[model samples]
Target chain A: MRIAFIIIAIVFVALTIAFTILPMGTIALIPVALAFLFSFFAFFKSKERKRIFSKWLMFFVFVLFLVIVAKDVFVKDKVVTDQKFQLEKQNSQQEAQKELEELEGLK
Target chain B: MKKILTIGVFLSFIRICTGQISPNETLIFDGSYELSGMMTNIAQVTMQTSVMKTTNKSYLHLSAEVATFNKWDSFFKIRDLYESYVDPGTLKPSLYKRNVYEGGYTKTEKYSYNPAGNSIKSESKRKNNPVVKNTVSIQPGAVDVITLIYKLRSANLSGLKAGQSIPYIIVFDEKQLRVNLKMLGKEIVSAGNLGKRECYKLSISANTNKLKGADKNLIWLTTDSKHIPCLIKFSIPVGVGQLSLLKTAGI
Candidate 1:
């Protein structure tokens, strides 16, 4: 039972990390909650010698939870203008205009 | 009276078949992605329309620009542009171009329409690749995706019944793709900054496999005359993508 709890906790922790890095908003909370629940249960069920790792896993999940909250509160979405893209769009328009002028029928 | 009614129905059918075009307008959408049971902002997409005049005639120029947020750029940067020039009166595409810069991959496709022969001359160029040229035949009034979207707004859809679908021929990747836009009735949806709007819910499907799942790609267009696309949801190979109306001009 303890091994199963630890394995599930590990999976949740990995998911939490990946989602947090993906910056997928507050979605990491799902894995964070699962990781906390399983890790807490595993910590209680484990022997004293094995308790250290479970405690660390719970702590990591807590840290990830804080990171997700912080990112949600802080991150601002902005589209940085790419000058090269703009230049290309302008050049494309010019070239298209020239080509359109050369086309046989438009009337 | 019966003759007048028949004429009215016929005109409405023609209007639905051939959509009108607004001279100029712009729409901005906040594109987001759904993953891990949460939706997150992914990019900003802006669609603008204007008139382009040449020595011979005037055309309605449509352009859509997509740029990923600075925060998401590191993971997967996307800077894409799609442009189409269509007849101002009929909304039939005269030329279309797509320039895509997603992550490390870049490609450009240009199609020049020949309405007389009902064919398109296509040119495709990719990064570090030779330009490929081909000619593909198409039915009359076939258009690119951008023009099709605009046409949807201007079309007289009152004659359409629920589950009724209209087929459209789209030019993409130097090939003609059969796309179906199905009416799915109406619903009131929250359209971000646009607030609660009564919309004509519709589903879009294509023969290509790029769009996954049936009924997964949905669009909510406002029922008003402007017919603004308030919210759009599409399923991509990676995941579900959504775009909500953020701002608008001349709607």
Candidate 2:
């Protein structure tokens, strides 16, 4: 029984490091797999307090990672295109009105 | 402690991901919206832009006094016909890059006019220096030569208002100003790193006689007053680029 527990702990350590270090968008999936594994193990070993502890811990980590990944994906992407020539066009027309009014009033 | 820290990091990431709130809901009338945006067909540079909308007209304006002054050498290296400077009278293309005063005024404006207000004139200029891409390009307001442009008039920015797309062919001051512009409908676009925003994306096109792609202009204006142009993609064979409005104007 102790050997089985030791192997599980070793696997957990390996998985945790992979989850943290893989980089890119895939890191988000780590906690979820960890959570599922822990939860499945707890279902089979319901009487063990260690199983409950691991299960809850892994689930919490999963939720947190999911949030982080979603944040990165949803950030805004935008740019500016200055409309100088357009402004010149519109304003020049308005300026023409003022110029014409000035000329007419002068007359 | 390790588990706690790991969870904490992920939680922080989530906060960042979901923190993108929409633009604020205040100030939702009908006028142009300015965005903290920039474009670079040359290199990675940001420019300021403004987009305006009325019942019958819409337009975008973009400019970077710094970019116009500091010509990118890398950009010149790529394009064959596109050099930093060219001969004025002959319009001959040349790679001769000239340095000018590094700053000047940048302005953009759009308006609605009756048919009687067609001719464009009455230009003001900076006393000594001018805002020319090249010193030899042309003096600001020197000849009062009106260049080519596309016209826009629309309601709610979902493409040009129904029945308002004119193949605008006008002869003003002996210059043939012809344009073919069409709107590309509405889209939900991101305005900032904050969140997604719904906007009307208008495609701008300018036909060229003096220049290759002088008749194209693209702009994205918010249907609402978050008043942001979520995205604007212009064109070139002339000089243009893509720009997006802020996704989160605190809305």
Candidate 3:
């Protein structure tokens, strides 16, 4: 059980680096969530509860990582989509104005 | 015999380097570009253009892999591909298609031009969205973005003055945009591995809000019958992106 937790923790750190350096988008969230589960096991099921400072530390780190990933997946994505919508709206307005100017030139 | 062999090799080398584009022949351009902002490289861009021999169609493909040097990765990895089937006799596009991917968003569009009706029927499909159908009016000889690049190659610009501007229309993303190309005279510019060459300097301005407060996009085309696009510089929301021709083939 301890070995499994150590392995998951290592995978979690590697995925964090990968997510930071690459445009993996929501794909990065899968590993982050899995790490969170492993951290929970480390905190509760580890045999060396008295000397398990590293397990508790990893648990907190995984929690923080989960928050960041959730914010990116839920909040940042929505903001980007909103900005694109606004840009499209502005473009349509400009197109209409240009058409009006052309009509006036013809008249 | 030695002299003849040397001359033949030299002629072939020239042909390979310049890829002398002719009206009746096809040409291909393969190149890479760099996008930078705030004095830092932000992305690597790859571009390829080829003319299909079987269908006589011209295709341009561009992809950008955004870097994560800023700690946070870019939200988008962009890919844009355009294909146009040109009428060999008229050099005008009869059909056009565009496939675009930016981050998680994707859209595919097909346009059919009807010269008889002076209109174009556009069909676009977005991810998880209903298909969009629209018909837009077009001017005579109006082309799409991809076709416009090739059309300008075959166009006669000898009569254009240094400060003169030519008006053209292009249909893109369901919008018929009026674009003006202003001649900024001719100058010698670097052509990467090809070294320096004389090129026609031109600036593009379009009737759109997206270009507000941005410098007009600049283009340098070779001042020859080939009329290859040697260099292009355009401003993005952040800074600028430059696309330069790196090599040519199949001319």
Report the lDDT tens digits of candidate 2 across residue range B129-242. Answer: 453221122212111111111112112234356324435443322234454445556678766663676666555443554333532465666666333545556554544455
Residues B1-251 of candidate 1: C-alpha lDDT, one tens digit per residue: 99999999877765654344456778899999887567889899999988888778888889999999997889889999999987676677878999999998999999988867389889998997999998888887778889889888877666778999988887777767899999999999987667899999999999998899989999998887678898999998989989999887765
Worst 10 residues of 3 chain B by lDDT: B62-71
Q: Write the per-residue lDDT of candidate 3 for residues B1-251, one digit (tens) a residue.
A: 99999999977654543343343333222222332212222333333343333222332321121222222225444444455655443456656666665666788787777745378778899988998999888877688877677666655566788989888888878788998888889989877556788999888888876553433588888887677677877764555556655554433
Q: How many Å off is the CA of B196 in candidate 2?
A: 1.8
lDDT of 1 at A43: 99
Q: How far off is model 3, as Cα RMSD?
A: 14.9
Q: Chain A TM-score for each candidate, in the given order?
A: 0.76, 0.37, 0.48
CA displacement after TM-score superposition, residue B187 of candidate 2 (Å): 1.7
Considering the two chains of model 2, state its CAPRI-style docking category: incorrect
Give the range of the ten consecutive residues with the poorest summed lDDT in model 2 chain B. Answer: B77-86
Give model 3's TM-score versus the native structure. 0.55
lDDT of 1 at B116: 73
For this target, which candidate reaches the highest lDDT against the unseen true structure? 1
**DockQ for each candidate?**
0.48, 0.01, 0.02
lDDT ranking of the models: 1, 3, 2
- Candidate models: Cα lDDT each: 0.86, 0.36, 0.59
lDDT of 2 by residue, A7-30 (tens): 464465456555444322344354
Scored by lDDT, model 3 comes in at 0.59
Superposition error at B224 for model 3 (Å): 1.4
TM-score of each: 0.85, 0.31, 0.55
